[model samples]
Target: MENLTATNLYSFYGKSPVLQGVSFDLKPGEFLSVLGRNGVGKTTLLKSIMGLTDRCEGDLKFGETDLLKCSTPQRSLKGIAYIPQGREIIPRFTVRENILMGTFARPDGKRDIPDYLFDMFPILREFISRRGGDLSGGQQQQLAIARALAMDPKILILDEPTEGIQPNIVKQIEDAIIQLNRERGLGVILVEQNVPFARAASDRFLVLDKGRVVLNGTSAELTDSVVEEHLTF
Candidate 1:
């Protein structure tokens, strides 16, 4: 467990600027939530850190390594795992196959799925041969997260994890995230719109407005009035 740092980060899409001088630090074994309304560059920030965006200017570092020049796959090998929005699973692949995909970045040659991954998601064991496209939305989300965990990442970036999901499954995912942070010492950057869930899961929070970080503080420092003013529309 360490920290991921983004200093003076700026990103663009063609001529349009999306993230403007966005900066933050994710601590070791800490859960940090990025909360913002639609089109506020929340997803852009995640992509920038993952090396998937067109970086205009920035310095990104994971632990002691500079990540600004690393490729997406290189970043993954450096211990960064991204669970993008929409669960992005390969529909035709089986549960086991999807999990195995995460091992592609491993330095070792083995392609085996760790036993602990199955322990964390026992349902995966039952559906090892089932195709990912056949699962429910919640089940797919679980699979997505489990797949990322299989990478043995030091830091996990999840975008809108609870989106379009049931309350029960949301709780399950939340519990799993907390366990990962507590037991495995995994650092997490969670970008979410569910205010209540984000507040409950995150130790610290950052709010983006118009592609800039407008507010930031610990979860306890955020008041209901502030949440209503900045987050509610």
Candidate 2:
């Protein structure tokens, strides 16, 4: 497994800076959570890592590979899978087809959907022929995650996997994410508004404000007082 490192990173969109001097690291197989209020650049930080930002400056490395020059597809091929907010699955594609789309990032040129994906989200298997748009919000999120896993990523970056989903499905998604990290040993970077889950699941946590990292530390250090000060609105 490879480690992800960012140093003094700056991300911009059309000359407007969104992430200013943001820096952090995700050790191989580690789980990191990002917490911030609305529009504080949590999503921008992830986009910068995937090369989706309009511009970026400073060093970003995955293991020994410099990521600054890698295109989004190149980064995906290198085993970085991003599940952005909104669970953007191809609405017209069937559940199986949406999962297969992730195979395009595989360096081996194989297109088989992993059996484990269906195992992780059984609802997906039950609705294998259903179009993505026809699924409920929670099911669509599951499909999005299944699609990401089909890439066989070394690291998974997710923006609010449980956001705006049904209450019961939220636990399922959270459990799946934890299982992927703890049992499957996938490195994970999560942006979450659920402070309790973030505190419980993360090996480390970062608190952002105004597009900058105002606080970061090991999970144990993310005390309730810290949450109140940095995370509570």
Candidate 3:
């Protein structure tokens, strides 16, 4: 496990900046939730960490290494797995093939999916030969998570993992994420609109407004008043 630290970070797309002077740190094995209304740069913050932004300024360090010097693949190889919005699984690829792609980031050069991933999302095992596009939205979300786990990441970064899924699957995904953090000891950075889940699952939380962090504290500090003031539209 490693600590991910961002200091005075600024991220931009072309000439427009999405993250402005943001600073935070995720301790080893800590579960941190990023909360905000839409378009508040919550997604951009995760992208910046993954080196996906067009340009970034300031320092992003994973453990003792400087992350700004690393490429997207380098970030992945370092054990930071990002499951972005839209659950971007390959539409034409089979479930097994999609999962194998994650192994490309493994430093050990192993290309096999872990059996635990299958146990977490049995639908993926059942649809192992099915094209990724053939799965329902909820199933695709599970596939996305399974694919990320195939890499055996130390830190899992997720953007709205439960959005638009069926209620039953939503509970399953939530339970899985909690299990990953609490039981498996993986560091987690989650960007979510679900305040209830965020509050329940996170050890700490940050509230973003516009492109800056307006409020942040331990999960116990994330109250209804804070959500109504910052998160509720």
Candidate 4:
């Protein structure tokens, strides 16, 4: 479980720069939260790590492999799973089908969502035959995470897992993440606006302003003033 490092990362949309020399390290089995106001390039940084955005310059590496050279699918196969902000689940597909999609990066013949996923998200097992669109927003979020876990990723990048969800469901998701990190040694990078949730779950914090990391510290070092200045709108 080596760290994933982004060194001097620069990303752009067309000719406009979004991330300027952004960098961070996600250590093994560690939960790191990225906090920023809207349009401050938090999502762009996540997309850059997943290779969804074009890199202007810099390097992204996990262990000995260079992630900048990998395609999105190749990144998935290499053990990075991203659950984007929207919780993109196929509306018409059954919950089972949506979860199964996560395994596409695996060898063609592989079947069955891992048993532990069902154990962690038992609600998904109950809704296996239900259409994704029929579930509540919270349920959809859970399904999105379950699907990501089906890929057996080494690093899970979650963008705002608490958005628009009920408090109870949010707690469930938080518990699941903690369990994964504590029991299975999964590394997580959380991009979130919910400061309380981020403070509760993450061991370290990274705050981005405009596009650069303005602060990097342990959770204990993330003062209220810092959160207000850098993360609040």
Once model 4 is optimally superposed onto the true structure by TM-score, how far is the C-alpha of residue 113 displaced, in angstroms?
A: 1.1
Cα lDDT computed for each candidate against the true fold: 0.87, 0.94, 0.94, 0.88
lDDT of 1: 0.87
Candidate 4 residue lDDT tens string, 1-233: 67899999999888878999988888888999999888889999989988887555798899888988888888888888999988999999999999999988664447679988888888899999999999999999999999998888888999988889988898889889888877998899999887887888789999888899989999888789988778776
Clashes of each: 0, 0, 0, 0
Over 4 Å off, model 4: 107-109
- Using alpha carbons, what is the TM-score of model 3? 0.98
TM-score of each: 0.95, 0.98, 0.98, 0.95
Off by over 4 Å in 3: none
Q: Tell me model 4's lDDT, rounded to 2 decimals.
A: 0.88
Tell me the spans in candidate 1 whose CA falls farther than 4 Å from its real position: none
The lowest-lDDT stretch of 10 consecutive residues in candidate 1 is: 103-112
lDDT of 2 by residue, 130-169 (tens): 9999999999999999999998899999999999999999
| lDDT minimum window of 10 residues, candidate 3 | 1-10
After TM-score superposition, the amount by which residue 43's alpha carbon in candidate 2 deviates from its true location, in angstroms, is 0.5
Q: Which residue window of length 10 is worst by lDDT in model 2?
A: 224-233
